[model samples]
Target: MLTVLPAINWLSVLVAFVLYFGLGAFWYLFLFPKPYRISLGRSANEPQSGNPLYIVGPAVCSLIITLTSAVLLYALNVTSYGAATLFAAVVGGGYLVTNTVNIAINPNIPRPFLYGLITGSYHFVGLLLISLLLVAMR
Candidate 1:
C-alpha cells in the first residue's frame, strides 16, 4: 500500500515542540522540585549534584516526544481544536500516562504513585497544550 505523507505545517510543529519542551523544564526544575525529590526518596537538603546528563537527557527526550506528537497531529489531519485535544488526550492520558503508572508500580520502586502522578500529569498537560498550539496555529 502506498502511503502519502501529509503537508506539514512546519511553523506550527516547531512552536508546539518548543512549548512542550519548555513545559518539562518548568515542571520538574522549579514547580515541583520538592515533591519530585521526595518521590525519589531524596532528602530536600541533600545537595543535588550539577550533572549535565540529568538536565540534558530528559530535555532531549522531551524534544523528541514533542516532535513526534506534532508530526502525528499533522499526519492525522487534525485541524479542529476539539479533535486535536481529543487525540492528544487519548495518546497522552490513555497510552502514555497508563504506561508510566504501570512501570512505576513495580515492587522495586518506592512511592510509585507519587512518581507516576508527577510524570503522568506532565505528559497529559504537555500534550494538551501542544495540541492546542498546533490547532490554533493551523
Candidate 2:
C-alpha cells in the first residue's frame, strides 16, 4: 500500500530496479539458461510462452518480499541509507547463496532455484539502491 512515487526515494528505486534488472538479465543469459534447459530436458533454443501465471505469480511474490523487508527495516530503526543497502545485500546475498547451494546440490527440486534467485535478487537490489538513496538524501 506504499505509494512508491511519493513515499520512497525515486532515484534509489530507479537505481535498484536497474541493478536488479541487470542481474536478472545476467542470470537468464548466463547462470540459469543451461541449468534450466538441462533440468527440463528442453532444447537450448526452445521458444518461451508468455504464461500469466509464470510471470505474475513470481512478480507478486517479489513485491511482497521487497516491501516487507523494506518496511521491517524501517520499523527496526535501521532506516539509514547505508543500513538499507547492507540489509539488502545481506538478505539478498544470503538468500541467493543458500538457495543456490540447495538447488545445485538437489537438482530434482521443481522450479529449481529460479524463484528464489529472482525474489532474492530483487530484494537485494532494491535494498541496495534504497540504501544509496538514503545516503544521498542525507
Candidate that scores best on lDDT: 1
Work out the TM-score per prediction. Answer: 0.86, 0.54
lDDT of 2 by residue, 1-138 (tens): 343324555454445444554555566557666655544556667765567876566545545554555445545546566676677677667764465546544556455455455544544565566455544542
> What is the per-residue lDDT of model 1 for residues 5-73, given as tens digits with 9 covering 90 to 100?
355566877887778878888998788877877777887556666999977887787777767777777
List of clashing residue pairs for candidate 1: none
State which candidate has the highest TM-score: 1
**Clashes (N, CA, C under 3 Å) per candidate:** 0, 0
Candidate 1 CA-lDDT value: 0.80
Clashes of 1: 0
